[model samples]
Target: MYILKKNEKFNIDNETITFREIRDKLTEEFTELVKAIVNYSYDKTLKNLKAVVREAFDVIQVCILILRKCHTISKDLDYPD
Candidate 1:
């Protein structure tokens, strides 16, 4: 997880990705959807929005997979008393 300062700067190390990157990527996708909806015809815009949503869902699924893998690794490293 990356922490943001008051000025909205993130402190992420080079080797690791912070949650902020995921959030920003999602936000950019949503903005693209909104732009497509506003600038294109109804049918075309709807298709574009659907595509954007599918892509966003894929990103979320990837994040979930990564988190699950991390959880499994963490559990393996724990000691039972």
Candidate 2:
């Protein structure tokens, strides 16, 4: 997202990012999401549920970033659009 660009600390750095790095980050976010869901299932608290939403958003954002970056890299590799 554009907001990620604005935040220097965010991990979505195009210059240094690679497919492997993004995929690893995605896996980490997904793990957190699963943990949040497991906690929510047992606790059913609003805060725990909110964590699930937050982690889900993180996963989605990383996936979108990966797609955008991959589109550029794929072109260089001569992959069809």
Candidate 3:
């Protein structure tokens, strides 16, 4: 990918490559690699998930307070554990 560019000539192996080719070849390569990494196993309890929800809601409440719209709205959001 670093060696190829559109309308650019490479003087190696008596062939030329373009960025479009590099992009096409590497696009799905990166996507597949990311998908492999994204398929991860998370062994966490419902309590842990509830804690995450509560923490995220706490920050959201702070943002709502700053926006001066619905600070209490976040308080009403309950985490079912």
**Deviation of model 2 at 62, angstroms:** 0.8
Ranking by TM-score: 2, 1, 3
Candidate No. with top TM-score: 2
lDDT digits (tens) for residues 30-69 of candidate 2:
9999999999999999999999999999888888887778
Q: Taking the tens digit of each residue's C-alpha lDDT, what string does model 3 give over 5-80?
A: 2322312221233345434444544554444434422535665566555544444433332333233334556842
| TM-score for each candidate, following the candidate numbering | 0.44, 0.79, 0.32
Q: lDDT ranking from best to worst?
A: 2, 1, 3
- Per-residue CA lDDT of model 1 for 1-81, tens digit only, reads 322222122232323555566566547656655666555545566767777666556455445534644654577675522
Going through the candidates in the order shown, the clash numbers are: 0, 0, 0
> Where does model 1 exceed 4 Å of error?
1-44, 79-81
Best of the candidates, lDDT: 2
Q: What are the lDDT figures for the candidates, one per model?
A: 0.51, 0.79, 0.39
Winner by lDDT between candidate 2 and candidate 1: 2
